[model samples]
Target: MKLRCELLLACGLFLALVLIFWSEALPEDRTLFLRDLSAEIIPVRSFWVRSGGFALWNPYSFFGMPYSANPQNQAFYPFNLFYYFFGAERGLVFYIIFHHFLFVFTLYWALREMGFQREGSFLGAIGFSFGGFFCSLSMLVAVLSTLIWFPLIIIFLIRAGKSHWLKPGLGIGLLIALQVFAGEMEIAGISWLLSLFAILFLPEDIRGHLSVRRIFLALGLGIFFGAILSAFQWLITLEFIPLSNRASGFGLVDALLWSIEPFQLKSFVIPNYILPASRLSLSTSAFWGLGFFSEYSYFLSLYSGIIVLLLALFSMGGVRSWKIWFWVLLAGFALAMSMGNTLPVYKFFYFHIPFFNLFRFPSKFLFLFYFALMMLAVYGWQRIQHKPRRIFGFGVLIIGIGLLLYLIFSRLNLEDSSLGAELIAHKFFLRSSLRVLAFFCLGLGLIFLLGSNMRFWLSAGLGVLCFLDLFFAHRYLNPVIKRDFYRGNSYVQEFNNQKRSLVYPPRIASLSAPSEELSFQWLTDPIELYSRLRDGLENYWSTYFGIADLRAYSLFCLSEVSELGKLLAEDSLSPGVRRLALARSGVEYIYYRDYGFVNLSLSYPRALILYQAKIVKDREQIFRIFSDANFPGLRSVLIEAEDKVAGDKNFAPMSDFARVISYENEKVVIDAEARADGWLLLLDSYYPGWRAFVDGKEVRIYRANGFFRAVKIPAGRHRVIFNYFPESFTRGLLISGIGFFLWLFLFGISFKMGKGRK
Candidate 1:
């Protein structure tokens, strides 16, 4: 019977996803076109495939940075084999669907293990997997990928505590490791905290004869094992973070940037009541939220389901088990934390908690809140079986109060009575409130009218209604476009064909257009607006077209490269500085939104040999030299004072030349000749791992021009090769291999012990 229920639940989840995203699932030509999908994920995955299915470096973005080391790329994630097998477009569709299924099914399994009946467990699973917080994450694929494992980790920890078994603890470690590989460390950290809470505070029955010492031991094992298992990725990330722009943790104000506004809580019941009348529209002009529209607009509808909220409230009333109250408290905690700066609790946590300052978007804590609410709702459903009339009364009272409040607010005039937008918002709120009340009435009627003995039919009917409620509210959040939308544009193709570096206009310049004009264009014709946006070749769009971009979007960037980018954007500096910086970075073409790609006629060679170098102890001196209008950046180079190179500053190299013979993602080979000793300069971002070889002999690479690599060269023709081989990756791989073997050994022991017990 349990096996049959599991199979049915799986089928229901698959069918729901198909119905919700039919265009993406059934059609070969349609695909999702949400924010990060195009801006970062698809391009990175495509680049990984283009680099022979595994890449250690990405030469296309930020003037070449570590590809595999960027956790967002998910370089070592096992599930990415789908991309390797089916390509990015189809694989992404499958990846999203699979993770959604995983989320629902894992929640169902966990609830069942906690002794909830199949019907109640199914309700909770549906409520959460289709909840506001989870649905809002559709655009953030990495966050969703990491978040799906939260329930599984909690359940495994519970099992390990109950059984005092090494195998279950090891299993939890593996799940945590998978979450880390999913490429959202912030979500993983959040999941770990929630899992710890579950094992430590869960009600006695749910914990199942737990021992305090044993539970702590299991949690410790899981943490230690998970750390070692994911060392390969995290080790490299730790080494890279200090060098990147996010070296220091975020400040409280920055961390609270996306906190849920207290007024926005109405969304949990009324669904986008704060937005304009056409709340379903994707236009940014329609959003009037606290933060950037793009961030909050995707979650316009935070309504999980009217019935789910009602049942959760019902669970809170009446004499309940400690289990139910525990969920209530947990939900309250999550809600308080999600309020961020609006509440004192979040401020306390920010100052006192470790790793709390590392992540932004305090609203993400809603994931835990929704999960707890779903659990309470499940318990309420079970209780309703015996007291259906009581729950019906409670639902009527709640809906009655909600409708009364809606009537009052709809007629009340705002302080800005003349503002037409406020009137439109009021209209939207009234319309949305009516819809929510109608759904609430129908759900209440379902519980009141259905016969007590007709259990399966009642659960199935309510489940369908809940699914429809969430689907209608949030379906438009993820818009689909033609699969070929990713095909390179004419300008992108032309730049790629030329095999030359391209630089886009500064970010501030791109946004300099008047807000009204941008909104008008977006409303009148979004497709044309998108074309204009793409023409700039911003973000990883250039990477998708196989063109290197000097300006690109990334979560982590080398501090030196970021400093150079700032110089390029400084209007106060001489235009010559911008031109010189672009030329030194080997940019042959510059892209402007108004005018397409313009040729830089005096672009410097990508690889060059210089006989003269200035060793500067202060970084400001290098910047000053770069700022000089007459600085000969191409013929001479600035080296850091600590770097000692075997090159003579007075040795004027006659007819010196260097050119790149081969360039791959991880390795570059250059052929050079000089009449006298010189330094070979490669216009790629200088990082810690790259090793330079002169005629198969090792040579130290020095920081050139603040953010480029240079190696000393002899006075004769020779081949110089630069290879990336970071020690962190090597050490991490060894540690992960050991973790894998230890996990396997523990699994074998557990299996034998189970057989003996049987």
Candidate 2:
């Protein structure tokens, strides 16, 4: 009977949530991430076209792309690639659903791991799913996806708490790896939270259970493994990985703005409200500064503020374990609340610290506060062991109802009241069922507190509530929210409304065309480009943030024009540091896109179209047209070769340096210098694999480091030759050595520790 009841409630809640998401269109404001993910995957598609290689991709694309070189491109930072490559149609919808499932499962597992009753786990999941963070991020697919990892990390930490050093070390390592795949900002924030929790939560005896030395060793091995494994591909792609970017963090005032909660809730039944005339926004014009608030009216700062306050109260007056959580939540809340202010503590922590440049958007730490609050709520409910006297219970319920009614009818203006009333019908049955359910829960809790005899009933009732909250009505809401909120702002709508000119790094397209101004006028107006631009940078900004560019009106939004122009010029430069500027007058080729908001629209082809637009009639013949914006037309190719050894007797003069072994299908090899220290042999090809040897001795060199490759010989010179293949063997051996040693070290110590314990 108990099992059946549990199943019915869980099923009901799950169904409701699914319905809400399905009915609602994907939310628009946060939907940029889905679009961005789609944009980043274009290169992978291009890779398939060029090499037919479908291996798991890192952040870098091998085809002379910037993502391969720039650290900011961070792997999976472009998430939608997997969606579009695997599921061309409805890929985003499917991905969002998958995230919803992950959120539910992870929440369930995390609560269970924390030793909550089955029902407690269920309610905890429900509360978190509907928490302000998820609700706001649901509209943002990439951020939501990244956020899901937090629960799994908590689960691992709980499980690890019971184990020896190695197990926990490995668990923490895996969590770190997952965060890295999500990108650096996420990894940093999550790592900080975990470290803070570890210091606060883990008992000293348990930590001492494994000697500090062994624990440190295990942690070291885990970090070493994690670093190499997660970054190996990145290391190989760019030849090295960097720790920081030149651009990171906000000014004190800017960060403070992020810290302030823009929304607050006065009463639960009514929607949350924003204070337009508050300190954060002294006037309507001041509030409109960012264009974010002006463009979107659905900011939920009020709701967030209310939920946080309730959570704070719920967390107070708890046992040892609960108190730890309370303090952690308080710390997070304080940090979030200080985002825009210039407190000495925040300034010292964020600005004065050396590596603080690694993090941006300190305000996003609110995610930690949100999670803490959800867990505290669960703990509070678990602690509620007494029932009010019958008269008191009825009176309290009446008071709650009365307060809700008064707020709904009197405090709220007509428009707000009408809005709340409309939602009243939408949730009337579910809310009614919950009220009745709450009474039952209260009775059982009171019974449990009074006598141990009713323990089973308490557990049973808790389980039932869990089912009702998580698995039933929530699932049904999915469809409704998806239709109403998610789908309403199609990329087309955004495209039609924006008036920003974009400044993209120079590609073959940009070089072949002149400037963005001509490109926007001919190919896409500002409004149309707006939606496409959001899609392009969606995944990019999940970890890497910048303000939107508004170059179309000869205006700037979040970017500095001179700096951007410099970056463009640098990218368009040759290895020799010479600038290669594209035609600037006129061009007469038109590349039309049927899908105005597709990935192809954001690809190099669109940039090229605008580039070609800058060309005049004279340069028209130099450029052709590409239907897919991602596949830009090749305008002109430049080739230059030089033999560095001119004066030395490194075999011959520049003309006498002949191609030794040439393969049309792959690459060409040349026999040249067999000299020493300064004797350089340059075998330049577009494809990979070129190695040089001197007198049967292999000379190893790092490709794309300080130099591509250099061979040393006696000043007089001997025999020198270069071989061309796909990859160099030296890099492969080094990678193998690192992996093998790391594995052996971790396992060896773990085995020794096990023996010692035994």
Candidate 3:
């Protein structure tokens, strides 16, 4: 009966998620494709599908990058099997829905494991999963996927510590590996930090049963095993990091971007109260925050429901148990740290802590604060069941607070007429506060009138109320678009037919300053803007259409490629200089919103044979040479001084011809005829792990033209092939295989032991 009830509840939760996202649940409807989804993930997934299997290289973006090594690609995540079986479009919707259900179910399971009643656990799960943070971040596939494992990790860590068993430890290890594969290492790091806290400050009952030394050993071993399991993903990521834009970590100020302001705390109680004027604008303009709306607006609706806050406060009133205080303290710590520069604590951690500088957005710490609140609310529910009469007092106090804020804001009068916008914002706040008060009264009435004996009915009513609260508040966050949004674009079709490299305007041209109200008009109606941009082939739409774009969006780019892009985008450089640089990089078309695709007159072929070579010792010198208007980039190549190139350096001009026979994601083939010994330069981003073969014999690849690949060509026609097969991936695969078997063996032992004991 208990198992049946739990299963029913799980089904109910899944159904609720589907209903909340009913528009997106349709086969033709999709979430808005604005940031990472359109620019990075969809295009990469489309390439992977077109390549017929898992591929290592993404030649369409960043001029050829390691696709598997890019963490955000999520190349090895097990859940991506859905994308493989069903196509990228439909599969992404199912993938997101599945993870959201997993989040709610896992949190409920974790709360039950922590000794909460089923009713309370269910309430806590609903509040947290449908809360502001999780709901708003649903569009961010990687972050949402990585965070679903948090509750599971906490549960297994506690189980392992208490049981002193290898099975749960192995489970934790596998969970950790899955998170690493999910492609958001920052969230994975936060999970580990929270798990550490959960174990260190466990409730007295569980802590008393644990052997401290054994628990620590289990945790360390589990972490080590997890590292071994995910060695392939992280090992290549480590190699790529130093070459990436974030090689040296962010500056202190940059790292503090998106820190929650002190005034934003009101968001915890009032919906749409953070930057109320911007919320009223129904767009991203006038966002008076530390970072842009795309970065900070996701977590704006921090209202987890008025009943949740009231119950949590009620739990804090009496001399609570140590477990209750544990959650309270953790919540306080997370709230303070989320203030970033507003508080001194985060600054100290940013300078002193090891990995704190690697990530921006201290507001991410609110995940912990919200998690702690969910736990506290569960405890509060348990207390309220016994002292049911006290609920009305707490509910009245919350309503009174909301009314007080509403009165205060309503009474504020500004003598200066310039505060008109501020007055409108205050009015919005007052309206939202009234809405919160109504919900508070409704929740209080449900609990008080139903009484304690009617547990099932009371729980059902409150569940519906909480769902409505969160649904109405955040339903518009990730709006749905028709499937036709991605298809039938003439620009995409045109680019696909050309099958050549393209260059678009830099991202800065599209970004609007916070003060630019007219510029932000497009943001007010994102669907219309997205539709217009689709016809213009904005962002990485070229990649999705199988067109190689010189400028594409990525979390990080190779330092050399980044510098090259900066030079190309610089207004200080002449258009001729920029065109010359683009021609050398094999850019055949340039996209402009007003003019559409324009053909470049001096575009270089993808493969070229240069008769002359110049060895430059300094990298900057190569850029300087390229910046000059008179440099003959078509005939002469610049080779790095450190790279050794065989053959004649001063070869006379010959009838040398090179043509690309085949170009694929991971491999490229060129048929070349060199009448005299010269150099073959391929305008592809050069990095480690790419090997060249001439007539089935291995040849050295040299860094040419600052950040492209080059190899020596003999005085005969030869077939040259370039393949990307890194040794790190092979070695990591072997280690992961071993770890997999070890985990299986541990599971066997655990199962047998339990069977024997039974």
Candidate 4:
């Protein structure tokens, strides 16, 4: 009966969510992240997979980043295949909501398996799932997929404490493999780290009951098998990371950029009490001199909702176990980790821990606090025995005191210059306080009447209260898009509408900012989300329209692109020098995406697209032209092997008769008439896995202009083509296949041995 009730409520929750997501298209003002990152990539990925093409080389953004190796790609995850059935664009909401329910069920089952009854486990499910962690990362599909696997891994580990090294160990292995394959390694790493910690600190009584040696051996085997299964993804990622911007290491300043402010920590009591609410984004043009907290860290500010918070606090009263204290200490330490600069403990980890410096945003460690909150909340609920009236009275006393203090604070409209963001903070605090008071009162009434009854209905009401608290918080924290919100934008659809007349695979850019409003305090934090919105729109629109956006946003950028971006942002050169440099670099157009009313108007936006200069193809002589920044004489295209071009007697220098034949995501073809020996240089970012062919025969491809690609063309009208074939992906696939077979063979042998022994 308990099981039936939990399952029914879970389904009801999922169905209610679906009504919001599936009935209509997302709204236009929906975050650029949803449209640009998630929607844009999934469709392209599904197309390639369904067509049996190589799931690599995304040509849409950053001069084509490695699709499968990119952590957020979701190309290799099995569950994504299920979502792809509904079509990538339309099915995204389903995927998100699916994971949410999966998280709830997994947490409930895991706790129940650990000896908690339906009530305790259900409260925990509500605490973790609907408490705003997943909601904050709503568009982060891969991360959520990875996160849901975490509880299942713990469940398996718990089983392994009693079982032999075969079944439960394999189960653990399978879950880890699934998580790593889901794309986000950072989230996966955190889960495994937390898992190891939990196992290391298993309660002494439980350890004694299971025998410590058996627990250790099973866990070790499980992790080993899991590592083997996920070797493909990790192998590719390991190879790529050294070449990425994260290779060298980020500084301490960068690590603390989005760290949580200690003052905002009161959000645990009232989720909406955040000082400068993200929903209240105000433009600097309007409020340039005000104080506010415009920095966007992990949302929810560690809010576990008022009901859960109180329940968790209440559950804390009767526990005297030393093991419990250890967990509580760990929780406090985790919270400290979220305070990047405030605590400086992460700095210790940054310097001491391997690969720790490679990551940014230490505030994400809030996951630890979240885990601990659920654990303690369950403990608190379990302690509330048949004497419900006493606890109910205590709860009312607390609420009454809190409400009285809030009333006094509300009456006092104190303002001071040093009190940064206080005005908005107080207003939000007052509203959230009222909500908490109402809920606390309602909870007291429910406990007084039904807490003693101990019926399933009591648990159901508590679950409903959780739903209401989280849903209300979601209103301001992370809102979803409307049904009509997802239709193609006018700016993006322009290329498709005017397809016939435009240049083939025309390079485009979006100079307009993302139209995000900024608050006064945003000036201190340099995330510059508003300014970077143009980046999201540019990549999304360009990818969908089959256009090359010269300005690419990537995890790792080419040195040349870095230089170019630096030059552009700094405006370092004289006007003549700038134009001359750009002309030689094959720059064609500067585009401005019209983002309706919110767009920032630039004075000289035309300068981005207007480049007209002479093209010279001389493999050996181009260095002289680039030696001087202001040199206007004879602009030459730099080629990788000038000596090779000189050695080729038949090499034809082509400049006057270069024409684009065709361009696709994986292939590019051009027709050029060469009057003399030379190399055809393309000013595009170059990476591994690209092959060049002249007409029917394969030719040598070389790097040119520091970061572009070049090919040797013979002295005639020749057809030259470039194709992408990533060896890493191909090799990784083979390795994964081998690993899969190896695991199967091991499992088979283990099963046979067990049966024979029995």
Task: Return the top candidate by TM-score.
Answer: 1
lDDT of each residue in 174-290, candidate 3, tens digit only: 888888889888888888887676666655665677666766666677788889899999888888889888899888888887788877777778776332221223333332231
Tens digit of per-residue lDDT, candidate 1, span 251-329: 8878887787877777777675332222223443333331121224334346778878867876766788887878888
lDDT per residue for candidate 2 within 142-195, as digits (tens), equals 356556666665654554445565655665565555555554444346644654
Better model by TM-score: candidate 1 vs candidate 3: 1
* Candidate 1 Cα lDDT to native: 0.71
Q: Where does the lowest 10-residue lDDT sum fall in candidate 1?
A: 502-511
Ranking by TM-score: 1, 3, 4, 2
Clashes of each: 0, 85, 0, 14
3 or 4, greater by TM-score: 3
**Mind giving the per-residue lDDT tens digits that candidate 4 earns over 21-107?**
323334333332232333355445444544354465665454455566555665567777644576454456566667776777777
Cα distance off (Å), candidate 2, residue 37: 6.0
RMSD (Å) of each candidate, 1 decimal: 5.2, 12.9, 5.3, 6.8
Q: Which prediction has more favorable TM-score, 1 or 2?
A: 1
Q: TM-score for candidate 3, please give it.
A: 0.87
Native-to-model Cα distance after best TM-score fit, residue 530 in candidate 2, in Å = 5.7
Candidates 2 and 4 compared by lDDT, better number: 4
Candidate 3 residue 304 Cα shift, in angstroms, is 2.1
lDDT of 4 at 446: 63
TM-score, model 4 to reference: 0.80
Q: Candidates' TM-scores? A: 0.88, 0.54, 0.87, 0.80
